[model samples]
Target chain A: MDPSQVDVPPLKDLTIDNITDNVKLINSGCPDPRLKYLLERLVQHMHDFARETRLSHNEWMTAIQFLTSVGQICTDVRQEFILLSDILGLSLLVDSIDHPKPASSTEGTVLGPFHTHDAPPEPNGTQIAHDPAGEPCLVLCTVKDTEGKPIEGVKIDIWETDSSGKYDVQYEGREAPDQRAVMTSDAEGIFWFKAIVPVPYPIPNDGPVGKLLTLLKRHCYRPSHMHFMMEKEGFDHLITALYLRGDPYETSDAVFGVKESLLIDLGKVSAGQAKTYGVKEGGKLMSYDFVLVSEKESRELREKNAMYAMKDLGLRMKLYNGLPIPEVD
Target chain B: MDPSQVDVPPLKDLTIDNITDNVKLINSGCPDPRLKYLLERLVQHMHDFARETRLSHNEWMTAIQFLTSVGQICTDVRQEFILLSDILGLSLLVDSIDHPKPASSTEGTVLGPFHTHDAPPEPNGTQIAHDPAGEPCLVLCTVKDTEGKPIEGVKIDIWETDSSGKYDVQYEGREAPDQRAVMTSDAEGIFWFKAIVPVPYPIPNDGPVGKLLTLLKRHCYRPSHMHFMMEKEGFDHLITALYLRGDPYETSDAVFGVKESLLIDLGKVSAGQAKTYGVKEGGKLMSYDFVLVSEKESRELREKNAMYAMKDLGLRMKLYNGLPIPEVD
Candidate 1:
């Protein structure tokens, strides 16, 4: 044993009951308090879960193999781990924990695996739907603060699936980006672009996560939606999506990413109105005003919510353990 | 939504508190009961762990990346996930759960990442060590049942690290096996071989698991030990190792794999006996009688223990949740 590890108590004759404590004790030597806390609680839950389930050796090996496959499948353009996290509802849970917002502000969601930094900058009203797979729609969106005041110059990166239910990145040997673009809000906090109506699509399921979903008998399709990643100075960057209200998968998005506030209805725009945007006739118009929280407000909310979340968790644990929940007063 | 999914109620407008239930509900459609049970508990613990720690976005991403790297570093011969599980004490827990035995049987330990099926078969009394880095040692062993009767023709696979604390597999472009062999017990249920004195070795640490141990201020060395995997018809197969009695890392095996029953003290053999075994004058000797449990008995013990474990776990959970623990009849 190294001299640096002398502080960690020696672990010997480990049984099911004492193993977690010994592991945590060994991990207690970490220099960072936050990291130490995370490790301790992580070991606690992992061990407890194993014991509660009385997990068998075969099951554990299966989990190991599944995880290995997930890691092996990742490439420069793909992130299978994030996909696993999303299907498990973990990605959204973490996002919610970190990005609590006011009721009026747009709720954040899972930044699915398809976003890219190379989205070409386009002028307002430029057609982003290079592929003719679906009906044309003109997106008219505005960025605002909680006070409903326009916040100009916000860079919004937008991407979505075509009618075939696949992102441009999903195609093999794809030469150019389609149905995606980066656009900036005008001085009036408004940005509009021509795009195809987004369609419901299955996440990449040829990997282990896909196999898991199939075995779980769960569909892999997410509701038709347009992804938006907005960034501007002095405000919190937002990763969100606007789901079509009438989509069949709206109520049961495979990833559990749906939030009621992010749903929007599409309206018809006449040929004359559509022509003003330089798109073909009989196009649909989608409009929404997204509210961005200031970075200061986001930080304060995160801290406050973290405290509340821990307290609430402690109370649940107390109740579950048969201990009395503390009085709020 | 597919017609088959009508049984799974739609999940809408998910909140943090309700997402777990929704995820479980969707997963309830899995046809395999055992798999369904495993997934339920897995999600329960994973979510509870995240919530209890109030796991941050940064931390979650860190975990994802860590797992990815662990997966990516693996090769045909290297199993990093097993190493991760060993360090977390999960591998031992699962092993204990699946292979419960009578008190008289030899205890089992981790089957580490280094074992290979390609170990060349060697005759009894042959020297298995091809590397000159370690001191010569004579190993004498016998296989027996709980009733004290000898069990013949037991296949024993033996392996150990050289004095430099490296396995033959650890070296790049290695051509042949060294310090490892497969031998079978004779008609008298006895097997003898000449080998090297095993020494403590750190697990492969150039990867993420190593970095994690370093960050946690934990040593990565396992106590010097000789590996053994024994098998014979109609008896339980055993995977175990014998640790040296006074190895410096005995008490703090980085993987939490040490158990008292498996420790042994080495003894020296006289020059005459060493010559009989065809080893040098100063060679050490290791001797032990291994006991095997019948397959039927092992199956029974596992079933009985599994019931007790689940019952105990249920009681603990009930108490923790403030519910009354069930009375034993």
Candidate 2:
């Protein structure tokens, strides 16, 4: 008989809470220690959810669509799926659990949603932004080892949005890349940049990831922050982001990028003296030293730039299928 | 900034085998039990696979596409997706893991990729197919209770392919539903039918499922067999396929549906005796009976069917969005 032509059966009443035996069996078959443990745990939680909400097929399909969109919207520049991970708190948990940096070392936070590989190379203390589009501020920083001894001649790359919370490359209207620059730490492990105070801004949510947040009743704004990646001969290339302290949205940073140490106070300074530091007095200026643990090992120095990206296929039909599965970088 | 316009950073090296810790950490904050464990296991397997084969991103994408196709091609009638599950041994493993039938009782097998609900009612001893198609044989079957008592007046639905191992419905030029029929068990729990000895046949390999089998270098054929479903008031309904002993493809059953008890011997019989049994009785005939267990009090029985069905969206999506989650049957 044509199985396909048969009438559909009535729906069943399945849920997670009642499947302990089944879960046990599945676990028994999982030979991989990690996978076996995970399956056991995953199935347990799944069953618990089914039991808890009594979820329906329509709900399940809706989630499928949500995930599909997350994948579909992924591109080399953006990762909605990773954003989803961030919003769900999975990314934070992962970062925290994997990193056990000793005290005094710069704490690690999320790599935010955007991180460009290169910044225009600048010498020590060179200003990054070509123009001020936000509150003008002067930033100073120093690098040191865990022992608090200064480490000199280190490369530091810094990038951030203007007072408008916009990156230089973000503005197509910009005649040139405005706010990103590179610098080197001086003999005392000190370097400074002149730029506008960054402001809290909304993340790009016009796509499916935003739609999902709307559905989940979550906000799509990230706290204002600056990105930094420092590298010295034998030290772990530090990748981290610092958030503006007291930013109203800091508590609910969309990417959950804020950390206790990364949040810095942007104290106000007198206008004339601020001018000496390259900013209008009475505007916010901040100063802090980045104490990086010396490249402790070669492993950290060889770190891969942890950025999330997916392919886009809207090119011509000839390129639609993609480069015959091009080699993954 | 146009996120895509930034010079893309290199991706971190990740493998399926070494992802155990990654899964654990990523899901460390997941309050839901299943999602945490599932992600942990999935990551582990993914990393393990990567470590073992050094799989590239393109290959990973290929896997993602293959999984997507499995979901896309699935429908109520043609569950190629489920077949994919069976081929991967996931279905059987899941079924067995989730539903551990007593070793002494019928070992629940993969509910092959096809199953329909509405079957036209038929009476005891009524032949579903008139002409014998494959090997000529008489099917003898009786339903019994856990105590070995007879289950009289049970409804036994029957269907099988022809001597050439061709299912009537599988043929394009067919005018009728061949090699199929339904009959009820008599008061003595006995039922018999005459049909041609069936031949082994290959499963449909035109779809992505076939492509996977080819990629995995597996044979895609199954030994000829009869399908049956028996139900009565006192015991749980049994839905199972019975394989013909000595069928050429028995060892290589495509979906691995073979069971020791389900195999029926195909033996020669005298012509007059065949006439007595209402069969032509010259050639080989495959025959077998079915056994079913009684329904027990549990939450899983009510929802087992739904849980297995909802897994088409991948384990993660199923946990998040798919609902009406079935209990382990």
Per residue, candidate 1 scores C-alpha lDDT tens digits across B186-215 of 887899998888898899999999998888
Q: Quote the RMSD, in angstroms, for model 2.
A: 14.0
Question: Least lDDT summed over 10 consecutive residues: which range in candidate 2 chain B?
Answer: B8-17
Which stretches in model 2 have alpha-carbon errors above 4 Å? A1-68, A124-127, A130-132, A162-178, A207-212, A269-277, A297-329, B1-329
RMSD of each: 4.9, 14.0
Steric collisions counted per model:
4, 47
For model 2, the docking class works out as incorrect
Docking class of 1: medium
Q: Which candidate is the best by lDDT?
A: 1
Q: Which residue pairs in candidate 1 collide?
A: A320-B320, A320-B321, A321-B320, A321-B321
